[model samples]
Target: MNPINYLYLSALLFTIGGAGVLFRRNAIIVFMCVELMLNACNLAFVTFARLHGNLDGQIFAFFTMVVAAAEVVVGLAIIVTFFRSRHSASVDDASLMKL
Candidate 1:
């Protein structure tokens, strides 16, 4: 596929993910949306790496995936804790920071 097609697909996925993050009230759904956005970015990075015949983009994408994996672990832990404390996974239900 062409670079433009890759970019368009990435942009579309990113937009959908952003909308989900913004519109969803559940914390778990928001986290999943964030993951979607990260994967979309990874797709874009790999596409550019192939188009330019460079290893840097692939390396960056690898690093991003690692970070995203770490984020998923940490985010899920927090979500689990929040659900335990609040008994609900809705973002609006957890306002401990607002105090």
Candidate 2:
């Protein structure tokens, strides 16, 4: 596939993920959106790495995946704790935690 095609596909996936994050009310869905966005970024990174004939972008993508994994663990812990305390997984309900 062409690099441009890969770039366009990555952009589309990222856009959809962004919309999901902005409009979704469910915490799990929001998390999934975040994952989608992260993967899209990884795709772009790999595409650029291949296009440039360099390992740096691929290494960056690897680090991004590692960070994303850590984020998932921490994010899920927070979500689980919030659900346990509030009994609702709705994003709006989470605002109550500010107080």
Candidate 3:
């Protein structure tokens, strides 16, 4: 298939993820949408790397994956902690930063 098609799909996935992030109230759902956006970016990166016959985009994508993995670890920890304390995973319910 064409590289442009991959890019188009990536854009669509990113758009859907962005909309979910913006409209969703559930923390887990927002987190999932963020992951979806990251995966869309990774797809675009791999597609571009193949198109250009280079490893730069692939390297960037790898780093992104690494960061995302760390984010998942820490993010889930926080979410679980908040859920245990507040009993709700809604973003609006989190005012944990309140003084």
Off by over 4 Å in 2: 97-99
Report the candidate with higher lDDT, 1 versus 2.
Answer: 2
Q: Which wins on lDDT, candidate 2 or candidate 3?
A: 3
Error of 2 at 41 (Å): 0.3
| Model 2 Cα lDDT, one tens digit per residue, 6-74 | 999999999999999999999999999999999999999999999999999999999999999999999
Q: Which candidate is the best by lDDT?
A: 3
Q: What would the per-residue lDDT of candidate 3 be over residues 1-99, giving only the tens digit for each residue?
A: 666999999999999999999999999999999999999999999999999999999999999999999999999999999999999999999876888
Local distance difference test values of all predictions, in order: 0.94, 0.95, 0.96
Residue-by-residue lDDT tens digits, candidate 1, 21-90: 9999999999999999999999999989988999899999999999999999999999999889889999
How would the candidate models be sorted by lDDT, starting from the highest? 3, 2, 1
**Candidate 2 at residue 62, lDDT?**
99
Give model 2's TM-score versus the native structure. Answer: 0.94
